[model samples]
Target: MGKRFVLEEYLAHSTSNVMNGITIQQRCNDKGNEAIMTYVDHVIQGFRKDGFLYILLTVAPWCRFFPSVRNVYKNIQEGIAKGNALFDSLIDQREKELDTNRPNGFIDSFLVEHKKNSPSFEKKEQLRIFLKDLLAAGTETSSSTLRWILVYLIKEPKVQQKVHDEIDRVIGREGLARLDADVPYVRAVIQEAYRVQTLGPLGVPRQTTTDTTLFGYHIPKKHTNFKQLMACAQRSKTLAQPRKV
Candidate 1:
């Protein structure tokens, strides 16, 4: 409940809040589309700009649950500092390039929107939060998904061959698959891969808001606790069908 209150306060007033103060007009505009598109574009740009594929790859899982994964990120930062000097140089160069090129990218779009909305909002601070959220949430999860998909493809060569054959017949080597393209097989493969990989092994954690009674037991108010384990609650053999929450 305290955390929820803090989140609400941040959403209401924090200058760095990512989802705050977005207008419907802005959502319906080309600027919005560009903002969304540039998110992915800048990440790929950052990867290329930095030449830190391994770091980018690691970021995928970290971003999925940023609130919980911050400690992990701090540890990683410390570990990287103790490693090869050339890698550190590459990271520094990437940061400089990002700082230089950011104005031409998503940060620019966001700044344009912010200027239209609240002129008082500090654009630089907002940009920092926006970039952090994008890097932590966007790049990491997608990269991890792609990594798992590639691993699955490697494990099942026949599936890979079928996909390759389809690509050869349709787009060929020179062309790449577009998001709007009618690629059912590709979509199906991705769906199956995610289903098998199951990124949220434990699912997102939540806390009870108030005192509640369940199955004749009194759960105290403001208790930061998770529900009973699914495996413990339901018999494995009896679970034939999955029900929606």
Candidate 2:
């Protein structure tokens, strides 16, 4: 009967639950905020649709050559386009309200620097892509990593017990885990889960200038998402979907 709470709203309105001392509730227009909240669902659906597309591309690169794949890819591209339009709208609104004297959040901060014509900020498209990545990767990647951690913990009771003991020692029964918290064994358990089951199998693409090798891995001049190999070496890893980067 009531309205659903969305991630955008939570980030905008929350006072303490977020990080880096940013909130957009005060900065954004009420009408724009309402529109953004209503649109968040569609944006999330687009993001999930993109995830499916990524899986398809990764698993069956050959399918892309088929005629039917064109329609399927176009349909998915439409969904992604919707997400892009939503961010573009949000960016437009933020640009209208952005104040350099005191920036609102990440976008505003970036805009301030962008006004100075920073090379990285020269491309607004990059910022849009970053937002897409932030929303998509930030949510599913983290939750998937946590899910894998639980799977491994349940499979390995000793590791679970060590994590539990470490939690008790460091955070205690009542304390919530904070970013600033120090808990090595628990962190190691999470890290080990990452190693055994990599999250970002296809990491962000980066091209090398010259052929280079690091940490027993060889790098060619072409682009590489080394997690393709890490997925092979997964002794521990995190923050990536089972999907290739």
Candidate 3:
């Protein structure tokens, strides 16, 4: 929960910087965290539910014919649609005030680049994909990683105590921003956790460029080995298994 809060604030600030400079965190605080989280949770839910269907669609485009899968896709699209109004308004605001002299965030940056006459750039579609990736993929990955960290800490109290003691000694009353080269253990713990329980068990899927043979098995062009990657990760001896909370 705490991690989720921090992630939301980080995402909101990062996104808001580009959109207009109106910090969404401040806006959420004025309104209420509950409202913001509710919307985010719903959107993340749509992302989680649609994950399998999305993979299926990539591997077998015909799966879209299935009513259940189609419904899930529709719902996911609908969830993204809910945020379209707000995002579009922000984009519009940025469009009206495109100050290349002082670009605020990514939206402004994109606007500046769009003016560069880049033939390959499709401004609107790129912006939509970028926003969707940030809100949906970023939130889920960050929240899950933090949650996994806590799980590890809870299961291993000695490590947790060491971290606490280190923090108390190194940071004292100072905030995390005070952390510097002196914080090796803190970084180590985070790195180890990332190695063991990465939220993305499988790395990003990639399509084959051409026909290939691996271990006597034929792989056609455009075939994705994302599932194979996930399986290998799961079987990795170095990856730690989670203990009961």
TM-score of 3: 0.70
Candidate 2, which segments miss by more than 4 Å at Cα? 1-65, 117-123, 208-227, 231-245
Please give, for residues 1-245, the per-residue lDDT of candidate 3 as tens digits: 34534444455434433322222213333343344345556765654666667657766778777887878767656766766755676567778877888876677777787887675867776786676566556666666666678778989899898888888887775655354547788788887777666566556778899999989999999787774444554554744653222
lDDT of 1 by residue, 100-158 (tens): 33333454455456645877866555555554444334444455566677777888888
How close is every model to the real structure, measured as TM-score? 0.44, 0.65, 0.70
lDDT tens readout by residue for model 2, 88-201:
876888899989998888888878888877774445697777766655445455545665676677777887888888889898999898877998777767666776666566
Off by over 4 Å in 3: 1-39, 47-61, 83-86, 117-119, 178-182, 209-219, 227-245
Tell me model 2's lDDT, rounded to 2 decimals: 0.61
Local accuracy by lDDT, each model: 0.48, 0.61, 0.64
Q: Select the stronger candidate by TM-score from 1 and 3.
A: 3
Sorting all predicted structures by lDDT, with the top scorer first, yields 3, 2, 1
Comparing 1 and 3 on lDDT, the stronger one = 3
Instruction: Give the Å shift of residue 114 in candidate 2.
Output: 1.8
RMSD of each: 15.8, 7.2, 5.4
